[model samples]
Target: MIILVAYDISDPGRRDRAAKLLQSMGLSRLQRSLYAGRGGAAKARDIARALERILDSETDVADILVLPDHAWSRRIEVGNGRARVPGRARPPGVHIA
Candidate 1:
């Protein structure tokens, strides 16, 4: 199970809280608003509920993406940067996706 959390929070304090909460759950920060790590669907739901408590629904938005661990086998990455999406290294070439 791979849990990817992406959020757009309106408040700085809320954003930091969300980041810390995700990190505490073992998800690493892939970017300012993205995180990923090993977790189950139940965990994802629970995290979503937790976010509901932490976020202002009218102002903030968060997405908790739950994917099977094996999904990474087909992971495609591009752009001039290190592999932001975990579970595999970027293949050599110019990947369009």
Candidate 2:
């Protein structure tokens, strides 16, 4: 399965923080606010829990989409740039719980 996360955050700081958090959690950034990775329900739950702490309920919204094997197999890409894996790179002095 594949897990995709996208967010709309009002605060620049929180938005950047969320991106770093997602990267550290093993998701690859497909765009500025979109990410995709391989994970299950447990992993998606974990991500939601982590994101909740940094996102403002009133102003921020994060969407986590799950794609089954069949759906992922028919995926289409029109861009030349590939998804870049962030590989444990996190913000300085930030400790992810």
Candidate 3:
């Protein structure tokens, strides 16, 4: 499965920490606050727990979205520039939807 991890953290320090943590967990950065990678349900749960430990519930929000294999196959790419999905080699210059 493909996991999409996104977070909104108000504090710069906490945000940087979260980003580093996510990278350490094998998630690849997709955007400033968005990460994506392949991981199982167990991994997802572990990641959530780890994130929760460092994030302030009062001011920070984070989520992990699991994209099914079927949905991944049906993903649409609609731009001229290409993006790469973690752990997979895809054609260059297409954005997966």
Report how far residue 91 has shifted in candidate 1, in Å.
13
Q: Give the TM-score of candidate 1.
A: 0.77
Number of clashes recorded per candidate: 0, 0, 3
Per-residue lDDT of model 1, residues 1-97, tens digit only: 7888899999999999998998888787666787878788999998999889899999999988998756744555455344544444332323565
Q: How high is the CA lDDT of each candidate model?
A: 0.78, 0.80, 0.79
In candidate 1, position 47 carries an lDDT of: 90
User: Could you tell me the lDDT of residue 35 within candidate 1?
Assistant: 80
Best by TM-score: 2
Candidate 2 segments whose C-alpha is farther than 4 A from its true place: 81-97
How are the candidates ranked when ordered by TM-score, highest leading?
Answer: 2, 1, 3
Model 2 per-residue lDDT at 11: 96
Worst lDDT run of 10 residues, candidate 3, spans 85-94
- Candidate 2 residue-wise lDDT, 1-97, digit = tens: 8898999999999999999999899997776788888898999999999999999999999999887866765665544343453343231222324
Off by over 4 Å in 3: 73-97
Summarize candidate 3's per-residue lDDT along 33-78 as a digit string, tens digits. 8777788788899999999999999999998988886676665655
